[model samples]
Target: MTRKIWVFDTTLRDGEQVPGAKLNLYEKLEVAQQLKKLQVDIIEAGFPASSAGDFDAVKEIATKVGNTSDLMITALARAVKSDIDAVYNSVKYAEKPLIHIVLGTSDIHVEKKFGKSKSQILNIGVEAVKYAKTLLPDVQYSTEDASRSEFEYLWATIEAVVKAGATMINVPDTVGFAEPEEFGERIFKLNDRLKNLNDKVLLSVHCHNDLGMATANTLAAIKNGADKVECTINGIGERAGNAALEEVVMAINTRSSIYNVHTNIKTKEIMNTSRLVSSLMGLDVQVNKAITGENAFAHSSGIHQDGLLKSRDAYEIISPVEVGLDDMELVLTARSGRHAVKNALEKLGFHQITNSQFEGIFEAFLELADAKKEVYNHDLYVIVENYYAKQDVHNENMTYYSDHFYELMDLQVISNINFPSASVKMKRGDQILKSSAVGSGPIDALYSAITEISELDIKLIEYNISSVSRGKEALGKVKIQVEYRGEKYIAKATETDIMKASALAYINAINSIVVDQLLPVE
Candidate 1:
């Protein structure tokens, strides 16, 4: 039997609490809508009593996104009356309103953070849950740093809150200190203890990634009978961040034989959601981050690529299509072997090639791979093109063109004047596109001309420049981050002309969108 794991997304709450990852009301609402599309069980909008801005954002999400969808709306509160009241007022209009009351039960938090005794914390948590239960049927109480708290004290707090009508009992490894085994034991014991009190109450675990074991600990708890997971998108939260929702959900899904549980998350929406949160929050998801990372399903090693070509299961445990990718990426890099190179060629429609021809191409590939970190398709194309030219084979199929949606053919910019203007010539397949625009600045004007020609809803969020080498004539390197339909794409270009470098960098990002990364609009 597959048990359904409840996914409570706190991206708008704990995730936004990161030092500089805060989002405006519009952005929060955008995330809530995306979360709803992702089919998370609950959305913790924000800590309402934290500020007027948060209160308004939570209220708006509850009334608009929450009430319109089947998802539950919730917010965090200390085990204080005023905090619980603020949460209630904000999410009152939600169809399924949940108030999350967190309090410290560990001796460290009780003595140092709150300066209160165990009994005082217990009373405050019980009173808060009791009040929240009066307003909504769903109320969760978290034992802050429960892993470090005395078992007896933690049990007593659990018994008290269950008695006070907390529908969900959350045990958080608040500081991410607990190992998987230790965390799982706590959840198992709590489940057993709660069976005698109120088995109907849910058992939830929230883990942090301080020791880089949050996903491991979370899976361990689920194995020991935790019914709910408190997580955030892209794992954005305090300090080292919370257990990533995508990692946890996909773990349960991919390794169902071990955990025998499933989540409501539509895994197909995982990529879009991760990109949306990363873009709006102005945080970049690490390329190697699990699940939604750039290289999660990308294979680069020679042995791995060979096995992957033979069978996906030889190296990949999960299919890229399962998480909404069209196919697993076989990255051509220095480590990639000849087998991957041949497959790359076949994928580019060079399927009918002589074995000797392929061998000739392979040698050239190795030389280029040694000189570069990764070989793009264009680089591979040139290798093949040069191979044919050396062989004196007039191959009509051999062309310098690619499947790029937009290629910068030419660029002309005029700046240091009242009206900073630029004209761009681009190629999309066989068609030529020419556009000109004036902006408040030179880079802005170049981007405007590109945007006008591409007709994409591309937003330039991050722009940076640096020098590849020293001196006045040093190669100016431009790096840019752009958002397309909520997903972020990064591109870099180096040129002696700073303005041309900026244009090429921006076009590289746009071409990335047009090539393979244009996520479908939900």
Candidate 2:
């Protein structure tokens, strides 16, 4: 049987440190629920000793709904009584609580940072772990700079903490200096030298990605018998960041044959969880990011497209579907072949194109492809509409505004009455006009002004407002559809202020007439 590797996600503790990535208590709880669904073996909730807010967040998470029985919920602490006490208080309500106490072990760290001798440092590590064990049986002791610590001192610190009842010993690559092979060999040598190491506690690895090798180093450490890998989602952390939980988990699962390890992660939830975190944190993953990027599965070019069509394995090492992504795309460009066009149409549910129809549309698409540089889905829709037009079939149906006027009889109405001060002008058929009047709100005033100036009298048929995205900073989106000159025009605009949104929406509608030629009834 393959041994189960513990997946320790420190997203709450370390990922929260990313600049501008702060999550309030509710957001943190939402993320914590996602981590739980990911089936991580442990969650380092936060450093409760950091501040009162941190303590409250940790404490609330410990007591909140869905604090499961088997999962080891944890909080980080310094190897000091006050810090340990803060962690203990926060996690006191949890069924299985882990107190993670960390202290520096390297001589340089001791001398420069702590001004303590080697023996004093060892005593502090032992005393802290022993004391924490009394409060909670599951105590994890970490050597902050274990990768750079002198071998003898590291071994001594490990032995001391183990004897002090530490359940797990974490060796961190604090500055991410160790190479993969060297770091793995270090764990192997420690296991060899300290024969009682496995007898007393499990070995864990905490790596940073300063050298962009954090995941590799972590896997190597696991190969050398480390039982737990500490990481964060999306590689978020201080400075260069930490190993990404998604990357590490996928690597372990995808290469299980080579590594002979497994983690209890719900692989399918990877993409959804990444998106949720990205949205809540307000960090947009780059289009080319691995695993969850928009372009991760997108393929272009004639050669690759042909090869991918033959067999996905020809160009893809891992199936996009394996990472909860859809099949690769074959976009039509000037270089695209007939196979690409047919395939794109088939995907869009447009099957069985006649020879003449295909030729006509293909020729027109090429012309459009030349003009636009790349034919998009919307362009394809236009081509299809034109084809249907020759068949005398209705490609689209129009609605009369008077038909739906009764639906607005008793609906809730909130109008913008406080119109901002502005100069208004409108024109039609060589008429320059100007007028202003306050109505129920700015939107009403703007409409009155536009009517006076343009003299292209139209009735306000429909208006709606929505948000481009969620949050206080979200852009308010406004859409207006109005009838004039026996035609209807739709216009849209997004802005932070409602008044600006109203003005922009009106302008967008008017531009649809003046600029895009979707003129309304005069």
Candidate 3:
């Protein structure tokens, strides 16, 4: 029998507690929609009372994104009336609104924190849930530290909240202490010992990642009959984090026979959600983190790759494509075969290179293959470019040009503007002035002198450099774009050194301008 699990996403509520990981309102809404598509049953959008921004985000998500039949939007609140009011206000427009009211339940929290007796805390939990029910029919109640609370006290409190109108009860392993067996036993006992256990409300588990056992504990909870699992994208939260939605879902999927569980998650959107969160949070997911990591499905070594090529199941328990990961890479190392090289080139977006071009590029590749013992994409790009560059500009249409070299006071001197490559030197009557100079850097010096000599004042807008050939002996290519007399010119060149690269680049820019028949302002 396939069991069903409800996914509760708390990315906005708890994930925001991560320092410097706050998402703006628009970003929050974007993620919330993604979660809805992921088919999360409930989304704890935010702690509405925390800030005006948080309040607005919760309200907006609740109003704009949530749908009634398939999804529910929720706002978190402390047991305080003001917090409850804020939460209620935020979710008022939600088609399926849920108010989550949480209060301290452990002995330590009751004494030092709220300074209330156990009975008083119970009363507060009941009253809070009751008040939340008045605002919204669906209310979720959480005992802040249920895992650490005494079992008898926790059971009595759970009974009180359910009686007081909490539609769901969230039991959290606050400190992430319980191991799988013990936690499963605890939940199993809760159902066995507690009265009206299944009749009153749904039972959910919220596990943390403090001991690196959140996913395990959550599974244990489900093994013992937890109806919902609370999690976040990438497992991001206050401490080590919550159970990753991807990990738990895939686990249940892979071991469905044992857990007998299924969730509404699309499974494919796991990668997209992981990437969006990583991008917004500016936190790089480790290459081997888990299901969505870059190298999660990567296999290296001759034996493994060969086995994978033959049949993925030979070495892989899960297909990379199933989780949106690209298939195995046949990187060109010293030990790589010809088939590997062909495969690599194909994967490089060059599926249809001419045989002549491939032959020329391959010869250089063999030379590079002898040195580094591995061929990267950059090395291949350079090899291909060298085969394509035209040497002489005599027959071709030419436009703009300039020169640069270093000068005193860290200034740049540019000179020797030319076009058509055939018109080398210019004459001013019998004066016959030649353009040349030196500057700080070769380009700077060349540009400064060129400015003095060209009689065409130009302001450089952009410049770029790259290698056009393979190995250290490869030629450097420079591209310069400049604005002269309200006209833009682009220059490019292949050269041995950067100084030559700069000269050619400027010349290329001037060539573009001249080719276009552009003239400087008078």
* Over 4 Å off, model 2: 326-338, 354-376, 385-522
Clashes of 2: 9
| Tens-digit per-residue lDDT, 333-443, candidate 3 | 556544455555565455666676667667777787776554554345445545454322242322212112111122223334431121113332234434555544556
Clashing pairs in 2: 416-441, 417-440, 417-441, 419-442, 484-520, 484-521, 485-521, 485-522, 486-521
Model 1 poorest 10 in a row by lDDT = 513-522
> By summed lDDT, which 10 consecutive residues of candidate 3 come out lowest?
399-408
**If scored against the real structure, what TM-score would every candidate get?**
0.85, 0.73, 0.69
* Pick by TM-score: 1 or 3, better one: 1
Query: How does candidate 2 score on lDDT?
Result: 0.76
Question: What is the lDDT of every predicted structure here?
Answer: 0.87, 0.76, 0.74
TM-score of 2: 0.73
TM-score, cand. 1: 0.85
| Pick by lDDT: 1 or 3, better one | 1
lDDT at 419, model 3: 18
Whole-model alpha-carbon lDDT for candidate 3? 0.74
